[model samples]
Target: MALYITDECINCDVCEPECPNGAISQGEEYYRIDPNLCTECVGHFNTSQCVEVCPVDCILPDPDHRETKDQLQRKYLALSGQATAV
Candidate 1:
């Protein structure tokens, strides 16, 4: 599944550089993750890097954009143009 940043985010900019997929970006007040670009770091890392770097623990699973492990890998590949979209 992809991740979402909560409103509680302190906008400390800690999680932006940790994202392997480049899904994280500066939002109006808090950081945001593009679901289409988020792969939960399945192909690049063992766990979500954003979550690990978030100081306020604002990053959480995006229930509305849930996808399987295989799907997440596919998303990563697709974003990088290494595989077809699933």
Candidate 2:
């Protein structure tokens, strides 16, 4: 599943740089995650980097964008411009 930043975000500027996909950005009120660019860190890390680094624990899975592991891997491949594994 893709992750999203909630209102609980403290704007500590911690999660933004930890995103390998460059999905996190400073929003008008707080930080935000671009769901399209978020693959739950599937191909890059074993766990979500942003969630690990977020002091406020404001990041959570986006219910509307739920995805399977294979789908996440595919998204990772697409974002990285790597050929999808067969």
Candidate 3:
């Protein structure tokens, strides 16, 4: 599933740099995650870097954009332009 930043985000600017795919960006109110670019870090790392570093614990999965691990892996592969065993 793609992750999103809630209103609780303090805009501490921590999560933006953590995203491997550059999915997170500054929004009008808070940081936003582009679902199209977000792969939850499947192809980049075992864990989502933004989630790991978020001190407010505001990053959460987007139910509306739910995707399986394989789907996420494929998305990551496409975004990264590299092949790897999932």
Best by lDDT: 3
lDDT tens digits, residue span 1-86, model 3: 99999999999999999899999999999999999999999988999999999999999999989999999998988888886766
Instruction: Please estimate how well model 3 matches the true structure, expressed as its whole-model Cα lDDT.
Output: 0.94
The best candidate by TM-score is: 2
* Estimated TM-score for each candidate: 0.92, 0.94, 0.93
Q: Which stretches of candidate 1 lie over 4 Å from their true place?
A: 84-86
Give the C-alpha lDDT of model 2: 0.93
| Per-residue lDDT of candidate 2, residues 1-86 (tens digit) | 99999999889998988999999999999999999999999999999999999888889999999999999999999999996567
For each candidate in the order shown, give its overall lDDT on alpha carbons.
Answer: 0.90, 0.93, 0.94
Candidate 2 vs 3: which has more lDDT? 3
User: How many backbone clashes can be found in candidate 2?
Assistant: 0
Q: Could you give candidate 1's per-residue lDDT for residues 8-28 as a string of tens digits?
A: 999998898998778999998
Worst 10 residues of 3 by lDDT: 77-86
Query: Native-vs-model 1 lDDT?
Result: 0.90
Model 3, which residues run further than 4 Å from truth? 83-86
